[model samples]
Target: MNITINRAAIESIILEVPDVAAAEAFYTAAFGLGDKLRFRASEEPTTGFRGFILSLVVSQPSTVDSLVGTAVEGGATILKPAKKSFWGYGGVVQAPDGAIWKIATSSKKETGPATRAIDDFVVLLGVDDVKATKQFYVDHGLTVAKSFGSKYVEFDTPASSIKLALYGRRAAAKDAGVSAEGSGSHRIVLGGSAGAFTDPDGFAWEPHLASQ
Candidate 1:
């Protein structure tokens, strides 16, 4: 089946950390993603299941290798080493603030015709209930591109450089080979002009006004 969706863009990712300054520095040097990362500090530590992933889809295998190398050099834990997968050359990393990231390239050279190259960004959130979260975003004006019966959901966010997606909590964790015991603050913020609101998992979505 084919699904067409229209929705707003994703401007930036807001992350809540125990120390904003440190996180800013770590991400800045690690993946050169500092430009897209915004930081806020919380007085108390975070707890519970912090569910989400910041994905970078590159177009070249070399770029993927370079990015993964930089992340390791910049103090990121290589949760999953980069390698050839059915999807392409990909790997996982846990950032200093405990955020998970999947870096990959879908170039035909790496993935053949199975997956096309994605020279873009995608923000995937791990949620306790995919159906409920998907409904919440739909009610708030976001559109869906594709979805699987309460297991996964993808939004039709093309106006911005980053796309949005949702996955089952345990499923997402299992994919990353990490425990789903995240607590405290989710430290995620969705940037858009859609107004301010919070999701069921306590993740914040704030409005973004384009510069005049």
Candidate 2:
């Protein structure tokens, strides 16, 4: 016999956009994302309902693709183009600032097996300098959280409430009790309908279809 319990789950990717109105318009026009919620203030975007809402919050710029050119010029590659994701369709671009943004649809459904447990997941980025990396995130849109010496810094996004930490790759390896192998050590696990990535440093991330 199986039992089911109702637990609140995280259902959206809260992305930091340069401009709220423009970003909103970009998704609507370019991807046909239906509008479900909005905010009067650019800083705080209030979302109604739960489950896979692609929440894009405008940062301090003017439009959705405002940073697109800068990102491409700064060695930022389009790891994945805006398409239908398990949660919806959109693109994932690494910003010149070293942060990857997933511009996608808010209507995508989440795909996962039923697990009785739930917890927040934190994404840690390996960088050469924590302070400088943290600064990059701050300059873009993410807010800086706690700092553990000059070796590490934490940044917060509105989506998960969990904090993403930036640290030296070697330091992160030490913390994980693994040798710091860098990006070369990472691997991608692509299954039939689900997939995850272990960046060269061996940090694992579970990425599902944006429209699963």
lDDT of 1 by residue, 1-212 (tens): 11123334567777777778888777776566534567767655666447887888887676677777777877788888888888777888888777788888775364332323336778888898999999998888788889998999998875434688999988888767688877766767776656787888777878754431
What do the candidate models score in CA lDDT, each in turn? 0.74, 0.39
Candidate 2 lDDT by residue in tens digits, 65-144 = 43333345445566554444464444455432223343433434334432211133344556666777667555544566
45: Cα error in model 2, Å: 40
Candidate 2 stretches with Cα past 4 Å from truth are 1-116, 159-162, 183-212
Q: CA lDDT of 132 in candidate 2?
A: 71
Top candidate by lDDT:
1
Q: Relative to the unseen true structure, what is the C-alpha lDDT of residue 12 in candidate 2, on a scale of 0 to 100?
A: 26
State the displacement of the C-alpha of residue 3, model 1, in Å, after optimal TM-score superposition. 22
RMSD (CA, angstroms), candidate 2: 17.6
TM-score of each: 0.84, 0.34
Residue 203 CA displacement from its true place in model 2, Å: 12
